[model samples]
Target: MNHTRDKESILQLYNKVLPKLAERIYQNLTEVTPLFDDFRLEKIVDTWTKDRNASTDKEISIENGNVQQLGLKLSLIGFQAAGAQTFDLSKDLLFSLDYSYYEVGPDKNSRWMEKPYFEEWTSKELDDIAVKWSEEVIDEITQKLQGL
Candidate 1:
């Protein structure tokens, strides 16, 4: 019922739990980075303070990277081979000869790729970590409040 106590409890939750949750999420995201050829995505993933109900707010943020673009392309139509082309040449005549040639197209092996690391990891995994950390913080606070 005390406003000051309520504020302190919220601060304790933010200060003790959010950082650990963010760190765990960041680590899980980084683990999936090796699946990508470009490592920049791993480097750009970070946790920062945001202005949410005061300066005590914290959040995990990822900067846009080329990996996202590549993932989209792969997801839509698979990987296209660079510099691939198909050619054909033919002639028709009495007692004549004909020839034809074509280059193989790009590999359509989309299976080699996966959904964007950020998307897959953040969908439910991050939330689960946050919930676990939150429960830990709440239990700790309750114990202290009850002098257990």
Candidate 2:
């Protein structure tokens, strides 16, 4: 439990899966509203902080057990408009993701877009970000639990 996972590997995982995640959510939101989902690598960014802990369970004595916890916050930079909002007529159409994470006692969050207006993003966008973080990032962490 003493090796660190390279940041490059983590970034690769994020890039490969983020857009796919977006597409999955987008397809599900094909109804009513003309709004649709499209994956944007340009304005999208994901940041992850790794906290590694090494300890054994007190309840059940284990020789040596270690756990690595990862906190990922995904953000989106886009544009959107409110009021009689027409995507076609909107003057501004940019917004970011609402990402909040907490581990033990520490809490980290993504930047909130509170300018011209918060982008009224489709549920798919939010859902996709969450899924990618949990799937691509969390899964790998669980597989290799070691201190970084």
Alpha-carbon runs more than 4 Å astray in model 2: 1-5, 32-43, 46-148
**Which runs in model 1 stand beyond 4 Å of their true positions?**
1-5, 33-148
lDDT of 1 by residue, 6-109 (tens): 22333332344334444653454443333333322111111342323343322322221111111000111121223432221111101000011111111222
Cα lDDT, model 2, residue 88: 20
Top model number, TM-score: 2
Highest lDDT scorer: 2
Candidate 1 global lDDT: 0.27
Q: Model 1, residue 148: displacement in angstroms? A: 55
Q: How much lDDT does each candidate structure score?
A: 0.27, 0.29
Model 1 lDDT at residue 68: 11
Error in Å for residue 92 of model 2: 16
Cand. 1 TM to true fold = 0.23
Error of model 1, residue 28, in angstroms: 1.0
